[model samples]
Target: RDNADNTYTESGTRKRMGRKGIGKLAALSVAERVKVISVRDGDKSGCILSLNISNKNADGKYEIPAIPDDQINFLKIDETKSGSAIIMENSRYSINKTIDSAKRNISLIFPFACQTFKIHLENLTTGATATIDDTTMDIVKLSDALLTFSDEDSEYNEYLNALHGAFDNGRYYRVLQEKLPPDQLPAQKVLHKALTTIKEKMLLVTITGEQKAFDLSICGWIATFASSSDKKRNTDFPVNHISIIANDKLGQFDILPDISTDRMGEAYVVGQFFVDLLEETELPDIAASNRQGYKEDDPRFEKTLELIRKNALRPILELKADATKEKNYIRDLEKANKAKESKEAFDRSIREVVEHPDFKKVIHDSQPVKQALETAWELKDTLKDTYKKIMISHSSDDKPVIDELERVLHFCGFEKEEILYSSSNYYESGFEAYTDIYDYLKNFFVNTTRKTDLCVIYILNQGFVEKWDPVLEAGAGWVLNSTWYPMYTDTFSSVRRPFPGTAYTPKLNFDMDEKQSRTLAGAIYRISQHAGKLEQTEETIFQFIKTTRLYHG
Candidate 1:
């Protein structure tokens, strides 16, 4: 097809999908004997095509075999006026493979078959027949996600309806609804939110050293499956293929290898793109040998590849990610809640074992009682002081800094009722609501008559230095000699140098570095250890400080 001498093209209203006239020779490679029959205006002609060209007539042309005209007429219907048919005898192609394979191969190669042009395959030995038409996309009907784009209004609308019907009232939605918790958004809403917008992409690509630019437009549908195995697809035919079609003819069976990012999601993806401009008559031929595919360096082909990668493939994967994150979040939350409830019940039963009637006689010698007593002692050693009330002293302006500290405390196994902050709603129902603010502080901090142990954490910042209430709380901690620590939010340089208002100098590290992370972890570990609420190792808290969004710049 590349050489001028062998290139033969036909003129028609539609662009020709073929250039070279060597398709007849392909039959010789698949079959031993090939019969070609033609009927034009009721005139019949027949020939026996062969790979051996030595049997030629005196005119130096291949010899034609004589056959009866009636034999060719019976192969066609009475209404047919003009058509050609090739019947290969003793075929070598279909012998090794099953009938279904032949059907799938035909479908794979010629995906543009529609109502006007259809292909039918039949197995004479088994009576199995398959027809290819507009329903070629039905193979991907069970896919978990689908994305369709086309410039043509009719085709785009058709595929859009199919997408909505699949997600809104189809198998994926039903499964998610049955599995997910009722409080979360429905699967249909999540998918619809992700796929809310679609846009058509085009690029103007020009040949090298040429001023004329060609417009390349890519259009098609892409599908992704949760599972792509042959058994799941219910067919041995490989369905994870993205075909390229130009002028209603196969250009390449798959272009995914050229455009894929090698992500796992790529294995589940399949689609076809129609780029008619690749076969434009006015442009130089860009197709590879035998129309297998386009030359990779061709500008039009490169732009088409870019369009498919950026527009079509990306959106489908994002939709899958959104749906997966939502489903996993709900499931993980439910599991964590269940684990918390079970841990509480287990702890209560462990406490009851200590109150057993025969506990004292067997506690010293029996293995089971020794184990139970050790467990109870370890639990008491770690969490006995967790009953102490924690007071977080801070200004209202430093709410974000205090909130991060609250989260760290919760992570250390402190409950909502055990920790008190002025801004938190957990303390609103206590006696502090009705009593005077100054009187409540005196009663909470310097009230030696009270039985509860108290620990105060001073939030040292510019706001803390400027406000009266935080300074008063700090003075109370200093006077009562309560266990207290000063945690700085703003850098020490931003506040008074040498720290004027407090008894101890605040640490001068707020930048995100190894030293700062270690300092913060050490402070939190000491607080949790003093309250007997330490649950995680020191290294775990260090890693949390280094990775958390609150500390990252």
Candidate 2:
């Protein structure tokens, strides 16, 4: 206890994390008595410590009681190794409570869990034991990108390897937008120079009341960035933090609040920095009494914060910005290519149907046939896919409900290609976005063959009844005499025809409830039966609908 002071000289290579004697009193909070046992220089020793805050001696201080050596060795101490253990006796909570809380709490306080030193918690009552190790950190598990800075060569190489691994696996960026040629991207050498520059700076601070200068340098740190901030589910501790570690012990849980600019980019950032100088005994104690963080006014801490803000955090944000731009550029290119390919496929399908043997073998010499063929040319622009048995007609604003409707269709034994929705990929029949709407509808309803085979599900809402596009789709479905069903939310009731005609059938309710479930299931069953595609039983369909939530809006 006498050696516990501001200066540490216990070990040449390792710095002690606990210098104050306050930690020895922590067990007294939860236990009436504690058994201390140790093995040093092949000699075994034991003692019993008992403290009561409510009781005080005549000297106005708590009295420590001593017990026999036999009573102190309650748990067998291993004399084979030089070590120490304190067993809290008559604790307020039992080992069962410790088992539940130890894993997460211990991992947080002692985050440097490694194979060289491992802490195991065992329940003496049930003989259940758990070990805390390096895997508990989960720092590198699901990170999108990581940058490590260290002055040492081995540590720097290790960090470089991790960065390269993330890049190669396509996890370095949420979206890999590298559309430009490889030559255009920054070379690895240039990036290495830029990233490694973080460890080059040193901080100089004057020791208070001594007129002596102290040089401070960062030991190492790891910075992580993720695409999403919802990483608490994957970690045992608070995420998106920049913790400060001094002498292998956590000095501050997070320093980001003090140093951050609070930019949107900061949401993706998380890291830890190590600065042993914060705990240097030769210098004045800069850490707060709680030992959780350094004094804000301390020159040493202020400089360290400035160093991290400029060198460590800023570069990662710049890299994220560059990666995001690249991602968007590549996405645009892919969309453009997809649209072009769809347009070409639409042209090919129309030409194939128009030049079919049935249409080509007509007697052109007849005046009536010639006039009919001429009329057919004007309506031949309509697109058709015989495999598409269902068409979902709804306003673009009602996409959410249409999504649920698609799910129901899929559950009822319909493939993605067997249905058509303007917003979905199944509507690849033509360039619906670029083509003339009136001409396309005219050819689809009035010229297309086998109108009775198609079934349209119109999702009726205020957006649908008021929008010109959805109204046109509804009118086309009616004119073709195609089997159609109208579903509406509370926002609207009856369907208003696009051309002033009325639909006689009642609109099915689309709210998310038991009644809607039964109504939707029955409608789906009947539609499937009409299309000769009935696969799922009515009960099975109802059960599936029970698990899903339909429209609530």
The candidate scoring highest on lDDT is 1
Candidate 2 local lDDT, 1-553, one digit each (tens): 1133534556655667755756656677778887777767666677667765455689997755444545534244555657777877898655335564666566666766667668787777878778887532365555544556654453334544444444322542324324456654433221122144243333443334445555566644444444574454433456677878787778898888887754456676777667776777666677687767889998778888888887777666555544444445456457647855876697699778667877666654577976776677665544543456777787777676667677667667565665767766455533356777676566556643454556787877766668888778887887767778777654334455542323333234445666656667777888777666666766667665654456343
lDDT of 2: 0.62
Question: After best superposition, candidate 1 residue 193: deviation in angstroms?
Answer: 9.4
**Clashes per candidate, residues 3 or more apart or on different chains:** 0, 0
RMSD of each: 12.8, 14.5
Q: What TM-score would every model get versus the actual structure?
A: 0.56, 0.50
lDDT of each: 0.63, 0.62
Q: List the residue pairs that clash in candidate 2.
A: none
lDDT by residue for model 1 over 1-553, one digit each (tens)? Answer: 3333333344334455665556676677778778888877878888777765456678888775666777765444452577888888777654535566666666666776667778877777777777777545454455656666654453445554454455432445565567666666443534532232233344443333335544565556776665545215424445687888776678778888887754446777777777777775555677776557889998777877777877777667666555454546556457657855775686689678776767656666788868877864664444322223578887877776566667656656566766768876456323344666776676566442132245677777766768888788777766777777666777564344333434233342334567666677777777788766657666767655543445653
